[model samples]
Target: MSETRKCMVCGQIFKLRAQCPHQRYCSNRDCQRERKAQWQKLKVKSDPDYRENQRRAQTRWSELHPDYWRRYRDMHQAYKERNREQQRVRNSQSRQVAKMDVSVLDSRLCSGLYVLTHAVCGDVAKIGAWIVHLTVISDLPVESLKIAKR
Candidate 1:
């Protein structure tokens, strides 16, 4: 009978039934998974051959299972929904930024700091705080306003 060992992942006492003498993890599903993941991480860091082998294996698997990702996406509706939600948030943020720029330009035009030129009469008028009220006298169209030369 093997001596009881402390599980490194969960800190639980477990009896070792496996023949491996260096088994530091318990037979619990979560503990075993963590152990395998930790080992793989260390192996990949220290061993270049193992890392290359793993990469090759993944590439080969992907090549053989070309439709695997499609099937996974079809089966996992939550992933698709989450992706769509993130995309919508990104789009809304970009649209808000564009709208802010346009609104700033509109405010500048409405402030009347610029000069307005009459299209029909070819007359120029300074559109200041009180001067905009006299646009009818100058006969200047709204689209005829241009920045005054300082």
Candidate 2:
């Protein structure tokens, strides 16, 4: 009978066997790898419409699983912050070649004048002028500039 037929490769076919009619590979590994490669090739050849559909699918999934999306976003943001901090440390170390040390001046000595004195230069007159201008124009009170060493 047609139901009792055998496969050519494995030769152990049973009733209602082989879900895929076109399946030739008998091994599960070969079958899975073949399917994966086919899917990858198809995705690679897909047009903008296919990509839009995928985006819509992801949006629907996020809507359906709001908690999952929120957790994913939080994890992604934390990862980005960690990467940025690491990069900042690395950049600061590299910038030591041309970096100038800044000395914190005592507020009592400068009479409440917050001066950012650079060791490379005796007086940062331009920066001092800008700070003074900001103090006059902005809502920030001039008293806030009391230079306290961290």
Candidate 3:
């Protein structure tokens, strides 16, 4: 058996394995989380000027390296797509039934006026009913409106 080495992470002594050499943490997740937390703490403690410099350096690097920037963007997009798909699957599994509320329509205008207008127009039959209604009520000409499809 090979000699044991101390883990820099939890400070636990572990036997050297054939797969990994100088392993700081037992698993990849533990190592990644520790590194992320360490960097986050460092960033928090860093001066404003230092953070600005780092941001500028990153921007300059991306500007100077188009290929690197493209690859990084592609990888980020792929990761986002995968994560979104996983979230959609998980959400679809725990589907819930929601009830819609029905309320009575109360209008201050007289019922006779409402009935005459509704009779002249079949329940505001088209998309631009509000505009048309306003035009008709205000004695304005209804212009030929071109409705765009979404």
Candidate 4:
């Protein structure tokens, strides 16, 4: 009986092929693709000639199909919408705003009670807002104070 080994890519047990002794990845399409991708990544990082060849091939392909992505997006409405939504999420995450309690940079605000409301619908600090953790002790009307919560 042939010896069995675990596939490196998917961690599945696979019988060692008689033809290929050093097969580390499974025969699954995704695993094969991942193996190729890893090999290409290492090749590109280590071999300048391979990197240049890949770049040239990409440039050639781009030249041949200048509007490929535009046509693809037009044809695949769901893909375009999904990409737009993902980009919005990325933009929100990348915005230069704090995700935690606001740092007390300036001592301009008075030492009094305050309320902090969400700048937007959700409590995310990717956008600008004055926030701090607040506890209302007095029966102050809802018309008062800056608050930040962790």
Off by over 4 Å in 4: 85-150
* RMSD after CA superposition, every candidate: 12.4, 13.9, 14.5, 11.7
Two-way lDDT contest, 2 vs 4, winner: 4
Judging by TM-score against the true structure, name the best candidate.
4
Candidate number achieving the greatest lDDT relative to the actual structure: 4
lDDT of 2 by residue, 1-150 (tens): 334444444555544445656554445565557666777669847777776787899899988987984577577998778878999999987753333454443454433333344345434443432212212233345577554579
Error of 4 at 107 (Å): 28
Kindly list the per-residue Cα lDDT of model 4 for residues 1-150, writing each as its tens digit: 998999888999998889999989889999999999999999999999999999999999999999999999999999999999999999987765565445754465445555565343455535555555454454444357345668
Q: What is the lDDT of residue 127 in candidate 3?
A: 46
TM-score of each: 0.52, 0.29, 0.32, 0.53
lDDT of candidate 1 over 42-102, digit per residue (tens) = 9999999999999999999999999998899899999988988999999986754323213
**Model 4 lDDT, full chain set:** 0.79
The residue-by-residue lDDT of candidate 3 on 1-150, one tens digit each, is: 776876667666777777777555544567658967877679857777767887899899988986984577577998778878999997886443221342233374322221123234453334433312321232222243343559
Instruction: Give the CA lDDT, 0 to 100, for residue 66 in model 1.
Output: 100
| Candidate 4, poorest ten consecutive residues by summed lDDT | 117-126
- In order, what lDDT does every prediction score? 0.72, 0.57, 0.58, 0.79
**Where is model 3 more than 4 Å wrong at Cα?**
1-11, 14-40, 72-136, 139-150
Q: Estimate the TM-score for candidate 2.
A: 0.29
Clash count of each predicted structure:
0, 0, 0, 9
Q: Could you tell me which residue pairs clash in candidate 4?
A: 114-145, 114-146, 115-145, 115-146, 116-147, 131-148, 132-147, 132-148, 133-148
